[model samples]
Target: MTRTFRRGGTGGAGGDLDLYQYAYLAGGGLRVAESAVVSLTERGTLSLGAARLRVTGEERPEHPVELAVVVACPRSKPVREVIESVGHSSEVDVIARRLVSLGLVRRWRRKPTRAGRRRLADAASAGQVPAYALRGPAALVPGSARRGPLDVHPALGDLGRALTRMGKALDDDRGHGTDSSADAGGFGGGGGDW
Candidate 1:
């Protein structure tokens, strides 16, 4: 699948993107590739795989979830460093897990597979670790690079977008609290208006 993308968001202007051409754009099973490229600015113009998606929030802020990928990609830093930078958050953990599943990253405890070792060896032979190995924030846990960005499913994009929206909505709603004083019941705080 191929996807064409033009970037003009908070991340600044990015080059036109084609998922087929750049599978790295996606991470995990979230989503990858497309039959055609669509400008992310055009809402409802893009269809991920078979799922229909609308790019509603063009100017919406970049979600922490997105940053999670950035942190794990080590193209930024080591895994431990990323965790330290982002601090501990369930959200970050979720993103890390998803990233790991997508094969965008590897945990440290696992052994590298033949292919992984071969790739490492190849890099050693080349006298330089490829950017993918050095730049991307990956733990390289005992596992093989069996999966790459191409392995990410396109639907994951929708999931990421949805999670982003949900989180933002919650944050927005938090500012307009409407819960009753007694609604808290015994949870340890105020309750609803009861």
Candidate 2:
């Protein structure tokens, strides 16, 4: 977990990154997108509901991720579609590349570097980020996580439920193959004729 830096890059992007970076390092692009949505809707800049997300004001978001969400929803669009689209858009990719250059993430495997991990840990400890966000995508993987009530922002109750449904749909799409032969052999070499 130790990373040696060059002469000037000691702090790894000026000692620490902002909250959005922490969210991305903790989970992925989706986490950042979700956080932005919560913040925007809470401020009344955006209206997020189960069916649609609409921009209500000209509130230009400070974060690139938030801005991307706004751009994606120029008109009233399905909340699920907007969140997923913005989460996987070019904005997140740009942030990923920057994290790599800053030595906060490995280029290929895409795991956090030492500094990245420490930053996220510190942010989580300080309550700057949510515990669920720190849990990464697993926390959103539908049945994998209990369908308990989420204590989210008042304006984001819809967002929370939408995210849950989205995760369930993704989980279902991964494997609904009931045929015994479809996934009979475990994904291990030992299951083969060894």
Candidate 3:
């Protein structure tokens, strides 16, 4: 048996909203078992376990930098450099603070050598920023292998279809002005809105 999944954006603020597709194949039998879309909007619909639900709430920032730091694990680069590299200039301090609070990264002062200390003293006299390293995770490194369930039961087809419908309806209600039904063919017409 083999399982396949695809992820894409659902078109919203910062293009952070996303949609997912899950399908399973076994002995030449192919079935789509799930379709879900999540957004940072006020109200949307979701299908879960034979239930169609209307969800409403504020979307919170997930601090995407944390993931970037994780992927760059074992490399403790400077915080300012990390922010610049990740293009999070405006939220640099906030993201750094959040990551430190979550224990995902550690900030530390670089030990100064004799010559480095002289330069630091000169820079301090000139009011330059202090240097710090944003460390990555200690236990789990990127590309580490892990295992989990491969497929959802074929019996959940109805639930999958329901979820697709809800997603389409929500998209339509948002006036995105695109027909996602045609795109979501395999999951019974609950395709995503780019």
Best by lDDT: 2
Q: Candidate 3 residues 1-194, lDDT tens each?
A: 11111213232112211111011011000011111112111112221222223222233234333233223222433322332343332223443343334332344421223433333244334433111111111011121111111443233344334434433433344354264545755656447696
Q: Predictions ranked by lDDT, top down?
A: 2, 1, 3
Which ten contiguous residues of candidate 2 have the minimum total lDDT?
A: 1-10
TM-score of 3: 0.17
- lDDT tens readout by residue for model 1, 1-194: 11233333332212332222122222222222111112221233222221123333323324443334343332322222332333344544554454345443465432333433443344335433322223222112111122213445344355344323322332233342233545646576546687
Task: After the best TM-score superposition of candidate 3, give how far the Cα of residue 58 lies from its true spot, in angstroms.
Answer: 11
**Residue by residue across 1-194, what tens digits does model 2's lDDT show?**
11111222234364556656666788778776766665676567887554567899777876778889889899987665776898788888887888888888889977788977876666676665654456643364333532334553234365566555444443444463233545577675556565
How far out, in Å, is residue 152 in model 1? 41
TM-score of 1: 0.20
lDDT of each: 0.31, 0.64, 0.26
* Backbone steric clashes in candidate 2, count: 0
Cα TM-score per model: 0.20, 0.63, 0.17
Residue ranges of candidate 1 with Cα displaced over 4 Å: 1-60, 66-87, 103-194
Find the candidate with the highest TM-score and give its number. Answer: 2
